[model samples]
Target: MDNVNQAEFWQQRYETGSIQWDMGQVSPPLKAYIDQLPASAKDQAILVPGAGNAYEVGYLHEQGFTNVTLVDFAPAPIDAFAERYPDFPAAHLICADFFNLSPEQHQFDWVLEQTFFCAINPSRRDEYVEQMAALLKPQGKLVGLLFNVDFGRDEPPFGGTKDEYQQRFEQCFDIEMMEASYNSHPARQGSELFIKLQAK
Candidate 1:
């Protein structure tokens, strides 16, 4: 398998339709999260990293959020997303390595994590936490779903326990909420955790 850290690996998956993690639409729990965001959040900078097909990014644009950014290492999904939302700011559709995204140039008020965590190699989990903390503004939140079950494989969508996540993220964030998601897509119903952590 190609290294998960490289664009070639993800790009090949997108080109070959190997993205089993994509649910074809916004995850239910995340949709609920987005729907409740106050109108004042409309202009806050939001980042969606590893956004395959970017359905959540599309949803945010549809809801009138003006400063949403979507980053994917693969060009295929980024191009597909651009076609899906032609009017979305071209500057915001960044195709870059998430780890390489410089904190000096890119910082968000909040971040929407979907299946991105489990997609990266597990060895980089701490690096993921560090980069996420660096990417957020002070007290900004990192919110979304995580797989609660271990996939027992060496691949993307690699899974882990809530305890591991809590220990990892707590290094840079204050765990505001981490619990079983009551509204995941039927297929993922009992397997996902909806998390909301504010940068420390």
Candidate 2:
């Protein structure tokens, strides 16, 4: 966990091609969530933080969501994403630490969480919750998947339980939905929880 919170570690991972957590496609449960969203939701400002490869952002753009932002501290993935999506607004690809994002300058209708949460140091969970709440507009949502199983490791992809997640997030968000993901990718099935929490 020494450099788990640092960009260099992730950048090295991407550079060395050691990203096992990457599914190489948009997450199934998240895709289902996106697909069900009404057309009006297309205009909603969305943020995808710690967006490695940014498959979700690409999917959003392809589906005509204009106001999507992708943030990641690692340059390798962001650079690769830019190459993959040359037409995607350059301003939307933010290569910076998620915790450094200015709440006063950035606000979104919702923030999408994927592997991002698990990649952070466990001690920063509270900060993550507080920052997430701050980055959203009133009544905004924090939606996506969280690991429901603990990996008990000192590295990234660190996992946790539902009870722990509820305790950590409820201080800043109303737990509208936190349940087993029925449509997770095959590799993640039974291990992921699809969550939708509204900012309080």
Candidate 3:
């Protein structure tokens, strides 16, 4: 089994500051998406699994989103996030494996998939798709960016082509948008794909 499935492995990475994917802020594309959200969306139950630094969660809370849940395998980042946002509901910050989260107890209106999918074991890609479907309410959306280019390595942030992603995610989600990001961050300009899918 891949070590990325373990919490200890990720805890160590956070302790040593080994997360290169962390932009030290929310992803630009995601920020743009959040900026356009209607006032009615503030109460939607949202999940951000594998949320390392949880920058997106922070942004959501800052914008008055009341029902945001943040989950991370590692405790270090979660602890740091708690310190930064003391009033964020303590119960909403969960330090647990995303796959183990109970669908019966933790349903959501939508999920935010940042770098989480790429950080998991490639062998579990299908399982990820199934789990995401289970966690969402019917017609719930999963929106975020994915790497369009292969990183050619056997570690975290493992990348894949659009065809592979389309095939995998299409199993349980209705693909609304999956195309090259026109306004990605400078470093990710040509490498990212913005995807928005609804659970089907």
Candidate 4:
């Protein structure tokens, strides 16, 4: 799809408040992961793309992460998030396409994914993986959740299997972990995989 159309699609979802993917809070498994990270990691540059409402970003900020960035093309949710967290740095709230972000200009030590992947057009999966790799610093990690089952939808929340994800990501990342999350939110239980991949 063209840029204007893609932006409009997601924008309409936010405009209508039809975002079912907005978990309203950080996913439990991800919260646990954050709880265990070393304090020194607080300064690492981190990015969260397609970050609607951005509960995780808010959580990270509350936990004292100093360099967190939230990227979402949609303006409605971005505006809402800014309102909710007025103290969040305006510069860090990037309202831009994930694919358009530049590593040379916006390098990250890690990127946090929530439901962004399944929301994208499936044909762009390869480009998504490539862009993610390019956007990370060497050995940077992409850590977050992925759907393990099909949602049987024609629109957002597109889903896939583990084998497909492994094949697509393996060429550019070291798949350190991709398994059924031990502590997924009640609604997402058994259907979510927690992935931890490091740039190769």
Candidate number with greatest TM-score:
2
Q: Rate the local accuracy (lDDT) of all candidates.
A: 0.93, 0.95, 0.94, 0.91
Residue 115, model 2, lDDT = 94
Itemize residue pairs with steric clashes in candidate 4. Answer: none
lDDT of 2 by residue, 91-165 (tens): 999999999999999999999999999999999999999999999999999999999998987887889999999
Give the lDDT of residue 110 in candidate 4. 97
What lDDT is reached at residue 124 by model 4? Answer: 90
Candidate 3, which segments miss by more than 4 Å at Cα? none
> Which lDDT value does model 2 have at 141?
100
Q: How accurate is candidate 3 locally (lDDT)?
A: 0.94
Q: Please identify model 4 stretches exceeding 4 Å from their true place.
A: 1-5
Over 17-97, each residue of candidate 1 has an lDDT whose tens digit, in order, gives: 988878899888999999999999999999999998989999999999999999988999999988988899999999999
Candidate 3 TM-score, C-alpha based? 0.98
The alpha-carbon lDDT assigned to residue 132 of candidate 2 equals 97
As for candidate 1, its clashing pairs are none
Question: Which of the two, 2 or 4, has more lDDT?
Answer: 2
Each prediction's RMSD to truth: 0.9, 0.6, 0.8, 1.5
